[model samples]
Target: MVTDKQNISVNVVDYPYDTSVPLLDNEQFFYIRDEKRHKGRGLAAILTQPPSVQYRTLAERVKNQSKYGFPSHKLVLLIHGHQSFKNALYQPLLADKLSQEGYYVLRIDFRGLGDSEDCWDPKLGRTIKQDVEDLTTIYEFVSSEACKLLLGRTLTLDTIVAHSRGVISMFEFAREVYVPNLINCCGRFDSHGLLLKAARRSPTWEADGGFYCHTLRFGEWQDVWIPKAETLSAGTLDSSKFKEIDSGTWVLSVYTATDPIIPITAAAGYSNLFAGRHTLNIVPNCDHNFYGLPDDPNKLNLSLRKGKVNYGVYLVKELVEYLKEENQLERFYKTHQLIKSAKNEGDVRNRWCLPYEFSQISNFRDVGGYTTGSGTQVRPGIMYRCANPNEATAGALDYMKSDLSVNKIFDLRATNEAIEGGIIPEFDVENLSFNNNMTLSPEEMAKHYQGMFLSSYNFPQAYEIVLENSLPTIRHIFEYVLDGNVDEKHAIVFHCTAGKDRTGILGMLILGIAGVDVDTISHDYELTTLGLCTEKRLIAKINGRGDKFYTILGPKGREIAAAYGVTPTEMAANVLSSKYEAMRLFIDSFLSKFGSFDRFFYEQLKFNKIEVEKIKFHLTI
Candidate 1:
C-alpha cells in the first residue's frame, strides 16, 4: 500500500568544521527529518470526550504503545565519489527514498567537492588520507551532544553508503569507527589500475609533479589539478588495509556488470576479502553510474545514456533490502533481550530459562518444562541439547558429570564431522551419525546434502532427506531410552556442530513422540537463533566451506546461483539461520504423509506400540 511519494521534509544545515584538520573551514550536510510521532495520543483528549466516541481511539493508542512499539530512528550517511557532488548519480534519489522509509538520511558533501569550502593547498590536493580526515571530522561532529540537540532526538549512525572513490575513504574510516552496515557502489579495487589510467591520460604528469585535467563539476567542465601526491596516496591502498576493518561490520558491494569506468572484477576482490561478512550484488546491463542501455532497438552501446530503464533504482532497491535486514536483526536482538544476555552469564541463564551456563559451551539448554497435549509436563534436567563439547573446559566437564549428572551423550554428526570436530572424552558417548541407513555411497551422499544445504530455500527438503536416512539413528536413540538406559537420575545430551539443524530434527522427534504440539516443537527449534556460539560457528563454517560448495556446483550450478541473486557465502549464511518456518514446514510435510507421529513411529521408524508407550513414559511426567 506504500507508494513512492515524497512525504518527508529535508533540511540543509552547516556545522562548524573540525579545527584539528587543516585546510577545512566549513562543512555542509542535508538531513531528512522523520515526522512520524512515537508517543500515544493525549490521554486528556481521550478523557474529555464521551466514552463511546473515544474508546476505539484509546484502544488503538494502547495497542500502539505495547512492547513492540515504533522502530528507533536510524541515521544513514551517504558519501559521494571524486569529481562528483552530493547530488550526483543515485545519492539524491537514495536519500529521498530512505527518508520516505522513516529513516534520518544525511547526504554530505566532502570538502573540496559540492557546496563545501574548497581546499586549495597545492601540496596536499584531495588525497585519500585527507578524505579520511574529513570523514572523521564529520563523524565526530555527528556524535557530539550539539548535533543531538539540533536534531531534537538521539540517533545512532548505523549505515554508510558510498560511491566509487568514496568507498575507499569509507573503509579507511571504518578502521577506527565501528559502523554496523556499509554499502559500496561501484568501488574500484585495483589502485594500480587507477594510477595506470591516470598516467595514460597525463603522460608527463609524473615528470611535472602535477597536471591539470578537465573534470565535470556541478554541471560545468573545469580543469582540476591532479597532483602526484594524491595519485601516490591512492596507489598505496591495498587489500591488506581492508583487513583492518572490523570483522563484524556487514558489507554490501553493489556494482554494474557493464561499468565503463571500473572493471566488474573489482567486485570479486571485495567478496574475497570480506568473505563471511560481505554481500555482492551485480546489476546487469548498467554502467559505472548505474545508467541503463538506451531504448533504441539498434543501439549496441553499453555506455551510460538517458535510457528508460534506470538501474539506479535497482541499486537503491538492493540498499533498502540490506538495511531492512539489518534493522530486523537489531529489533530481534532487542526483543529477545540478547543485548544484556550476551554480556552477563547470569542474565543469559535467567532470561533464556537456562538451568546451567558453560563458559566454553553454547546452545546448551534442557528440553523440559513444556506441558504436552495430555496435560503432562516434560520433566526438567532429564534431556538436553547443545553444541559440540570438544572444547568444553575441564571444569565444565566435571560440572556436567557431577552437578548435572549427564552420563550419556549421543553425537549426531557424521564420521568425517566428528574427525574434523572432535568429541568430548569425558562422557559415555555414542556416535549416532545421521548418515546411517542411507543407500547412497559416501561421495554421492556428501554431494547430495551439500547442494541442499547451499540455500535456505532447500532446507525443508534437506530435513526430509535427513529424516528418511536417519531412521536407524532414531531407532537406536529410542531403543536406548526404551531399554531403561536413561532415567531422571542420569541425563542425556544430544548434539551436532552448532546444535541447530541435525539436533533440531532429533529434538522434534523426541518432543513429537512426547505428545508436544508442532508449534511448540518449532518454537523450541527457533531458540537456537539466540545462541551466542551458533553465530560464531556459522561465520567460521561459511569462511571455511563456502567456496568448496560453490566450486562443486559446476557451470550449471553457477547459472542457477546467479539467477537467485546470491553469492555462495550469502547462501551459506542463509542455510545456517534458525528460521521457525523451515522446521514447521518439515513437520507439516511429515504429518501430511504419515497422518500422525504415532503412525510415523509405527511405519517409518519401525517402533511397536509397546516401545512407543515406553518413549512417552520416559519423555514426560
Candidate 2:
C-alpha cells in the first residue's frame, strides 16, 4: 500500500523570486532553492496582479481569501510539465485558471527539467517520482507558509491538480501520501507504444524514451506492475486496477475525445479503476495536454486530433464547483424536481436549454418515462436530438466540446442549409447531411405533396430520393456509434431547428427503428409545439389567419402535408409505424440507392466505424 507521506512530505525552502520583467498578463517569474540541497532552484513563475474582477465583473470585487473559503489566504505550489516551466507560453493554463478560481496555484519546475536541477537517481531515468517528492516538499512548505500567514491558524492541503506527466506525479504522491483531493487532467497509462505517441507530440519529454516503458513485473494476480504503474509509467498504466485501491481521497479525471495522446475511451476506464470516490468527465476533442491543438491537414492526423477538443474558460468554473462540492464549502442548489402538470401523458413537454454557448443542435433530450415495448423506460442522456450547432453559444459550444463527449452528430438538413450555415467548426463538428428533398424550397413544392398528397403524398420517387439523401449522414452517425464510441455507457444527442421537421423526422426514424409505436413518435414530435412555442399564442395566430391559410402551413411538415393529397391512412403509417424492422426497411430502401447505410456513413460522411455503431445501437437495443 502507498503511504500517506505523499501529501505531508514536502520540505520548506526559501525560493528566490524572479524580479524579471512581467509578461502580457502581468506574470512574474520566481524560483525556490532546495533548502536541504541548498542549490539554485529551477525556474518558477506566477501570473500576478491579474484583473481583480469576479465571474461577472461586479462593481466591488471581494477579497480573494475571505471570498473563497480556503482555510487560509496563501498559495500552494503548482507543478508544470517538462517543457512548460521554462517556456512561459507552454505552461498549463489550469494553474492560472485555478488561481483565478481562488486557490493560489504553483507552477513547479520538476527535478531535472525546466528550471529545476538534474536528477540524482539513475534507475528511474528522469521519471516523475522525484518530482512527486519535490511536490510533497512544496505542499508541506506551502501549508506551513499558509499557517504562518494565518498567525497559528491551521489548514490542510485541500487539493492537487495535475496534467499529463504532472498528473502522474500528483497521483503517485496522493497514493503514497495523505491529501484531501486530486484532479487528473488527461491522465495517461504505462504502455510503451502510447508513451511514444505522447513523447512525439510533447515538446518536453520527447527525448527521454517517450513517456514510459513497460517492463514485466511478477505478482500473484494478473500482470502486476508497480501497482501504481499508472502514476509511474506514462504508457503502460492500467487504470482497471484502481478499483482495488482504497484511500480517503476524491478523484476527478477529465478527458476529451480530441486529446491527441490519451484515447477518450481510456478516460472512463481509468476513472473506473479507482475504488475510492471519483468523477470522470470527457470533453469531445481535447489533446493529451488539455490544450486544443490546431487541425492537421492530413486526414489521419486530423482523425487523431479530433479527440483533442478544448473549451474556453469554463474549465476553471468546473474546478471551482468541484472544490466546493468536495469540501462542503459552498451551498448546493438542488434542481427543481416538481412534477409538471399536463392534460395527458402525451402532453408532457420539457426543454433544457444547455449552459454552453455552442450546444449541439443535433443533441435533443428524452424524458426517462417513455416506455419501450418490453416495459422498460428509455434512459435519459442515452439518446438525444438537436438542431445544427451552426449557432451554438460559446458556453454551449464549450460544453459540447468539453463535456457532452458525443461521438457523432447526425445531420438531416439539406445541402443548401449546410452550405448556408457554412462549414461546421471542423475540429469539433462532423457533417452528415443527407436528404432527398431535391425541390429547393417550400415554395417550389407548395402545390404537390412529394411523399403524400394532402395526408400521405405517395410520391415514392421524391420520398425515396429524400430518404436516400438522408442515408449518407445517418450511415456515418451509426458507423461511428458501432465502432463502440456510443455504447450504453455514453449518451448521444440529435437535433435540427424548432425540434421538429428534420429533427422530428430523425427522431421518429430512430424510434421507428427502435420499435416504438407511431402514436409515441407523433406525440414526441408534437411535444415540440409546446416545448418551443406557446399554445395560446399559436392558436391565436392560427385563428386570426384567414380560412385560405393553414396554421401548420408555411415550411411546417404538418402544413405541407395538409396542402398535399395525404390521406388519413397514409398519415397514420408515417406517424405511427413502430417496429424496428419496419423502420430499418424504410432506411434500407432509401440507402439502397447509395449502397448500404454503413457505406454512406463511413465512405461518404467520413465518420469511422465506431462513430456509426454509437448511432446504430440506438436503433438496435
Candidate 3:
C-alpha cells in the first residue's frame, strides 16, 4: 500500500463553487468536484522535469489528507453516462483501484445527474444541447480558479478521463478548451445516433438539438425521431477537423468486451479514427461496469471475444508507459500548429503566447523568425507587450508577481485613466507619463479638426503623444531593455489599455528605434484585434438587439489600424516611412537626448551589452 509520508505542502485558495448562479444554458456546463483517497504502490511519476508542470500536489480534502510521502496527485475528471451519475459507486471504486495503481481520481456527477443541482427530464423538455453546455461549463470550472483552489497548488489535474456520455460532452469541451490529456472509457458516438437507435427500438425517441428541434406527428408530439446509426454510418468520425495540437496530448480509449453500449467493432472504429494518436484497450469477461455478476442491474450483455479482450495489468501498464514519454513531456507541448499560429496569426493559445498569461496588459507573443535587416528573426518570448493591467486573472497576476520578475511596467495610459481603473497592483508599476491626452475641449477640437481629424484624431493624438509625452518613457523603456534583464528570469512588460492605440504606437517606435522594420511592427500591432474580438455568443446577443456596429467595424484593416490610433497608411509608413518626417523627428529627438537609443539602453539600464546586442541583432536582421 502506498503511504504518502512526505511533508506535502498544500496551497488551496478558499474559493466558492456556487451552483445557484443562473447558467446561460448555452454552451456552458458544470464539472462536479469529487476527491477520493486510499492506499497503493507508488505510481511512476510522469511529467517530472518540466519545472512548468506542477507535480504531485496533494489537496487537504482527501481521506488521510494529511499523509505526505504518498505524493498526492490529481484525479482525472470523469463524466458518467445517462442516468449514470445516479449511481457513481463504480467511479469511486475505480478511483480506488487507480489509486492503488497510483491514479488520483475525480468522478463528477454531471450537472443533471446524481446529487448535482440540475436534473435532465424528458417531460421538462430539456435538450441535450443544454446538457452539452452544462458539461462545458463544468469542465472549465474543474480547471478554473475555483477548482484549483479546492485542490491547492500542491496537486493539480494531470488528466481528464471521461466515460460514455461524459466522453460526448468532453469531446465538445476539448474542441473549445485546452486540456493536456484525455482518457475515453466506453465512449459512444454522437447524441443523434445514440437517440436514433433508441427511437427505432422505443418509438419515444425524438431528435433534439435543444431549442431548434420539435416535431408534432398527427395530434401528438413524438419525443425524438432522429436515427443514430444512419446519421453516423453515413459519415465516418471527423477526427481530422480537431484543432491541431501537439504530440504531447495523449488519448487513451478503454472499452469492456461485454459492454452493450460500445461494441468492440464500434470501439475499434473510433480508435482507428484517431489511429496513431490514440491507444485502445479492451477488458475481458467484465461487463460494461467492469464488475462481474450476471444478474446485476448495472451489468450489460456486451459480448466480448477473446481476441478483443486485453484487460487488467496490461492496460494499466500501457497507460503508465505512454504517459512517461520524457522527451515529449519535457519541453512544454508546443504543437507545430500552435507555434505556427503564434508566429503568423497571434493565437493566444500558442506556446509563445503563454507569457502573456502573466502580464495583465502585456501584448505577450513569440518573436519567431521575423526577418531583421540582416536577414534574421528575433527569438520568441525574448520580448513582450500589452495593455495596462486594469484586469488580470489571479493566475496571471501571480505570474507577474513572481515568475515574470519583471523590472518595469511602462504605463502609457494617461494618469487619469490609470487612476480611473484603480491603481494596478504590481511589484513595479513605472509611470512613464506619455501624457498625450488632448488639451482642447471637445468643442474647440471639433471646430479646428478637418480631414481624418474627427475620424483620425485619435491616431494623430497618438503621434502627438509619442512626440511630446512619450520620448522620456521610450528612453526609460530603452534603458530597461539595455539593463541586460532580458536574459535573466525577468523581463519588462509595458502597456496602455486598448493596448492598440498608445501601446501600439510606443511599441512600433521602440522596435523602429531598435532597427525592427515598420511593416513588421504594423503586422504585430494589427494582430491585437484577433484577440479582442467579442466571442460569437456575445455578438449574437448584441445582434438580437439590432446591433450592427460590431459587424460593420470588424473589417480587418480598419480594426487593425483602429487599435494603433492610425490608418493603414500610417501603419505602412511606420514601416515604409522609417525615415519619414514623424518617425525621423521622434528618433532624432530621443537620440539627441541620450546619444543613440542603444547607448541610452546600455548605459542607463543595467542590461548586459551582449544580450542587448543579441536582441537588437534578432530584431534588425
Candidate 4:
C-alpha cells in the first residue's frame, strides 16, 4: 500500500494472490464509483512514474512533486486479459515503458480478478457485461472531478491498451465513449469460437454446474472455477458490437501468427470491420502470451524454433512506435497551432489570395482586384472560382447566395462529373460540357477528358487541348457574361473538381480578356495550390489515377520516370499540380500561336470584335 503526502484517504485492499513485484512503488487504491458499495469494492491501480520523476531519488522526487506537480498531462490506461491481474504478461513493462516516454500510465485489475472487490458470484460469475461495467466505473473515476482533486492535476485520457477478453470490454465501451487511441493484443474476434472450444474441453462441465481448472495466477498454478454463467455469457457476446465502435477511434490490433488460443483470421476480421481507421499487425513465431517455443535438443540443428525468446518484446515495440507516432502528431499540431488556426477562420482567410470564408467550401474566393493595363480594375464580387459547392453547409450556401449575391454558377466539368459531384440546388447552374461538339453523353465526355489528361505530358498541353475542344462552351460563357445579364449586385461562380485545371484555363481567359497582365494571370493560376491545401478532392484524384498512367506509358513510363528521377505516383501528383510555370507556358504558347487574346477569341472561338469588346466592357470597371 502507498500513501499520498497530501493525506488523501485511500482504501487499500489486498489481492487474492500475492503481488510481490519490485515495481510496487507506484501502487495506489481508487474506490470504484459504485453506489451499492459492498466491502472490498475498490480498484488496485499502479501509476507509473513519468520520465521527469522516474530517475530522481525519493527525497528529490518528493521535493519535485511538491514544487512542480505531476509530470504528464496525457494518461494511458493499460487493461489486462481474462483471469489476469494488473502486472500480467506485458502490462507492467509496457506501463513503465510508456511512462518513461512522458505519459501517465495506469494499469488496473478488474473486479473479481486481481486485487479488486470480490463481486463474483458462482451463479453470476465474471461476464463480459460485468467486465464492461467495471471498465466504465474505472474510466469515470479517472475522468471525474474526484480523481482530479486527488491528483492535483488534470490528465487527458489519450489511449487504452487491452489484451484478450479486455479487448471486448474496451471495444464495447467505445460504442458510446470516445478514446483517441486503442490497442488490441491477441483478442478473439468471435465468441462462438470460445464456446466451441469450451464445449470440446468441458462437455459435462455445464451439467456439473461448474468446473475447476488449474490456471496460472501471477506465475503460479491456482485452482480457478469456471462457472456455467461465465461460459453462457461469453458465448452470447455479439461480435457485431465491434463494428459499432466509434469510427474516430484509431485502433491498432496486434496478434501473433502462431497463437494457439486465438486464430490469425481474427486480425483480418477486425481489419475488414474497422476498414478506414484501423491498423492490423501480425508478429511472427509467438503464442497467445507471446512466448517463443524452446529449441528442440533432440534435433541436430535449431532452425525451426527460437530458444525461449520472449516475443512480448516485439508487441511492446509495435505499441511504442504507434504511440510515439500519435504523440508526435499531437505535439506537431499543438506546436504549429494548426487546430487553433483551423478554428479561427481569419488566419486561414489571410493566408490566401482573397477574403472569402465558406464553412464547407475550399478554394472558394472572389476573382477580383486585378489591375488592367488601362488602370481599370476587374470588378470584384462579380466573378468567383471554387471547388464543388455540393457539400457546402446550409449556412455557407446562404452566405454565398445572400451575402455574396451569387446568381449563376458555370460548371466546367463534364456532364457525368456534374451529376456525380452534384450542384448547389439553390443556384442556376449551367453544365458547360467542354467536349468538342457537346454531342457525347456525360460518361463518354468524362472518359474522353480522362484520356486526354492521361495522354498529355504536362498541364500546359492539357490546357491547350481543353481550350481547343471547349471553344463552344467558352463562346457561350463569354457571350452570356457580356449579354447584359451580370452586374455588381449579382455574381457568377465557376469551378471544376478542384477549381484548378479546367477552371484555371477559364480564369486565364476572363482575366486576359479584361486586360490583366500575363504575370498576374499566372499568379492567379498558381494560387489554386494554396486554395486546395485543405481539399481532399485533389488527393482522391491523384489516388484514383492508380496504375492507369503506368499501364498506358508501359516501358516509356519507366524511361520518363528514370529521366525525371521520380516514381509513377510522383508523376501523377505532378500532373495534378497548378504550377505558375505550367500556366505561363500555356499562355506563352497561346499568344505565340494567335498573337493576342483578340485573335485567339476571333480565330478559335469565332468571337466577333463587338462581342470581345462587350466582354472587356462588362468584366472591367
Each prediction's TM-score versus the true structure:
0.46, 0.38, 0.39, 0.50
Order of the predicted models by lDDT, top scorer first: 4, 1, 2, 3
Supply the TM-score for candidate 4: 0.50
* Residue 230 CA displacement from its true place in model 2, Å: 14
Task: Write the residue-wise lDDT of candidate 1 on 326-380 in tens digits.
Answer: 3545433333322122223353222233322543777787776555778676656
Question: Each model's C-alpha lDDT?
Answer: 0.65, 0.45, 0.45, 0.68
Clashing pairs in 1: none
Model 1 residue 501 distance off true place after TM-score fit, in angstroms? 28
Error of 1 at 315 (Å): 0.9
Please give the distance, in angstroms, between residue 567's alpha carbon in candidate 3 and its true position after superposition: 67
Q: Among all windows of ten consecutive residues in candidate 1, which has the lowest summed lDDT?
A: 41-50
Ranking by TM-score, best first? 4, 1, 3, 2
Q: Can you tell me which runs of candidate 2 are displaced by over 4 Å?
A: 1-29, 34-39, 42-77, 86-97, 121-125, 145-155, 193-246, 291-312, 325-621
| Tens digit per residue, CA lDDT, model 2, 253-312 | 877678756666557666666633678877544455544656633322322222543352
Clashes of each: 0, 118, 53, 0
Those runs of model 1 whose alpha carbons end farther than 4 Å from true positions after fitting are: 1-71, 213-221, 294-308, 325-621
Per-residue lDDT tens digits of candidate 4, residues 389-506? 7888778778777867888999988988789878878789988866543565455444434333332224555576677789889989988887877775788889988888788888
Q: What are the per-residue Cα lDDT tens digits for candidate 3 across 430-546?
A: 666564454645443332221112132123433543455445566566555555556325556666654555665566655654665443344454455442332233234433532
Worst 10 residues of 3 by lDDT: 37-46
